[model samples]
Target: MSIRHITLAALATLAAAQSASAYELDYSIDLLVPAAWPTSVVLLNVNPSDWASSTRRGAIEDAADAFLLNPSWFFIEPLEDDDSSIGPNNENELTFTSNSALLCGSSACTHLWYSGTDIVEADIYIKNDTYSVGNTKSDNLAYAGSYRSLQTLILHELGHMAGLMDEDGNYSVMGQDWNVLHAGSTDVSPYLDADSGAGLRELYGTRVGFADLSVSHWGYGGSSGGFSTHERNIVEDTSGVEPWHTTIGGEPYYVLGAGEIYRFEATLENKSDTAYTVDVSIVISPDPIITGADTELVRIPGIALSPGPTEVWLPALVPEGTTGLYYIGAIIDAGGDVPEWDETNNGQYLVAAFSW
Candidate 1:
């Protein structure tokens, strides 16, 4: 997923803050806590009259989708004390100054007063217009927290709630991998990639909560050609080979031939809310005609993927010295059961032939 931010552009939209960062663009953040439960944390959700005009619902929708994608880490709850009365956009206007955490910067983040004294009285904000904060009370999208497939603006704001600032934290959702993390404009939405989602799963999955084991697969017709043929770079789908699903418990049975480059593809859907470690492998079938042993194998790295559609690239993976039919498989590493335990090997698999 590509994270799109727009801080340098908030000017045209009329989003202006009273802080020293009045001219920067927009930015946003996410807070992961685990187990789909939102604690009694407090933060401000401001629209400032023209909010609907300046911000697109889609940006908020994407953020909501992320929260729904993983519920264990976040839950949108109500404010325990709105009675304290903090001014709408002032760094100093406030209550909840005890257990609360503030997300501010530019015009988007007006100010924050927290009640959690230990959180450290530090002032951190999105620094631009393109940034966003959590919705301890944001009711913009009613469809959030239903499923990962759904979207939410609150989650985007929570990222900000969790210090998703300027992309500098070690495991921050606001990290610099995005080109727009700088303090130059007002960006309404930014996205965290599949890899980042996985990282967050690992980071908050344990501390927050775990999810059920689920799976989804999508593939086109045989090598000869069908629905998704062109998408696979499958120049010509073999006429006789029909479509097939890999065994959930069997050892991989795919092969690759010498001098031939193979392209392996698969469609995956994250059935559960937690993150997933999706990977693929190319196995060489040890044949008497082939000189070397099948011992040499090609495996995918720590993919760090989430529960969604992802394509694994295996270019020219097999060396020329070896020639034979092989099986290629996508594996979902052990550990699907609760308590973070490993499960029997479960994944998507396919077979193919490589040639000179």
Candidate 2:
């Protein structure tokens, strides 16, 4: 959210004016009312003529996609029926404004104009004159120690338009401190962060059973004789074990040696309309032995998966002290942040033949 001009004495006057109005929601005061109903899909009209660079338009689309990735009921649709004009008649408009230099410097403003108690339409205005369009180093940066990008600012403002408030005294896109936010530029990948994404999910709805998780490959002790055998769902194969080997989708599991580094490869397929952040973990348990404590070998951090396939690799070393047949399992969404439609299908396990 951006700053506004409000004098100490002006507060009282504004309160009085709001009380006199017939509308239940006073536009003068800041509130958390949504621009549209939860069931309704809102339309946003981007003024294509305003941006000199095409990247800005792509940035706007990317910002919209970010919100759509969340489990929120609020949805945005671009008005493409009439490509000639952005909008001036009915749809909500997102346009550049050069006249709001007093309210903010190179920041964005969202005007939620209401008719009586219902919000008829809202407008998003960007400070095109104060901010650089394509340049990474914005001359008129808003916060002191922050890397403020135009796309990030637009995403924040869009969050506001979708009936979200600033998580003041916290770190989020809605927070006033822009220094904590990140833009998908250079090494940074665009994300809504945890807090903001959770808030949005709470408001709309949650997604469940949205991803298909699988371990594509697993192996220990480099390939023996420069040959590798891989399978999908096998317990153990101990025939002709020659030091080390690799497997590619084989049903029978290959032999794993003690004190050797093993590689686990897995892939996740997002079945939902939006992206997902998944927590992946590998568990090694007594399989052929079936009598020991299950040891969690490693846990990979949350990996962002778009509405498609994403691959991850985890390298783990087997302790030299342990000597037993174990089964390796790959678990997805270990924290349960994502509501899977099918909880039973979240993990895949395979039995392994081991040599100590």
Candidate 3:
């Protein structure tokens, strides 16, 4: 017998301070803990014919690859096409369907069948007719005037299969805001943020002697609320709605002046078990990608971070003679003092900006 588990859809809730990490899990009533896969690896079957566009198929594969990064023992291996249907078929499948009822009023959905705390079977469905799906913002916007990111949607559904609950109102792949356009930008990337990684570690185990630190967008008030790059200059609409803004390379950008100092709060997360002392640096770059080689604005060293999320307030200065658009971001463990499971995710760009 198969038992229906979880479903994903558009569910919204007020933003609240997370007691631990921003990630939540699917609980088992009998075990009183998170339901998870018994084995270290889970096999998934996908038909190439189901996706006519190679780019879309690649995007789906890329979403699966993101979870293999670090601090995640739960791995996925894609198999050849299988004929098993979605519900209680005893086969793990990933496919696209035109049926609106399968989507549950969302672009996609993941259904799982579990026995006690062990997830036995899972199926993922992506709506083909309701929305245009694309790999990039340009392709998406050009194709349908607006589009749904196939990669981002797949990543969120995969997170559900990994035993993670929907984290609405925060900067996470499993968040309710995991659409193509979010917070005035089309930045739904096919990458697992630190919060999602932490949740995976909680169910599985963590990588020893290594930590994954990251920074994400921080906001105040309820769902769909306003957020600011500069803390002192908080921008909010009269009805408490988030203001619309333009983006560069799918990331939201801000406007600032040279030689000005700005303060911003960032959500720093540690996706590991142990605590570590590391340095956090604020930097500026010409694009959305952030690196240690970027122009340094300030560095705060020796900050202790326990496992989970911590609110960090940082101050940055726009250098003189700086003009045009640049990314303002933070790099945790900038000096590489501490070892990490995934060094690529250590740096995160919150706002790309234009300086006058």
Best TM-score among the predictions, by candidate number? 3
Best by lDDT: 3
lDDT of 3 by residue, 317-351 (tens): 67788898777778888889877666776676767
Worst 10 residues of 2 by lDDT: 14-23
Which model, 2 or 3, shows the larger TM-score? 3
* Cα lDDT listed for each candidate: 0.30, 0.47, 0.63
Q: Which 10 successive residues of model 3 have the least lDDT summed?
A: 1-10
Q: Write the per-residue lDDT of candidate 1 for residues 40-101, one digit (tens) a residue.
A: 23333323222243343333444545444342353322222323333433322212122223
Q: Arrange candidates by TM-score, descending.
A: 3, 2, 1
| Model 1 residue 224 lDDT score | 23
Judging by TM-score, tell me the better candidate of 1 and 2: 2
- Residues 149-202, model 2: lDDT tens digits: 556667777776766555432234455423222211112223343345545555
TM-score of each: 0.33, 0.45, 0.75
Regions of model 3 farther than 4 Å from truth: 1-21, 51-53, 82-86, 129-145, 177-188, 217-255, 320-325, 354-356
What lDDT does candidate 2 reach at residue 138?
31
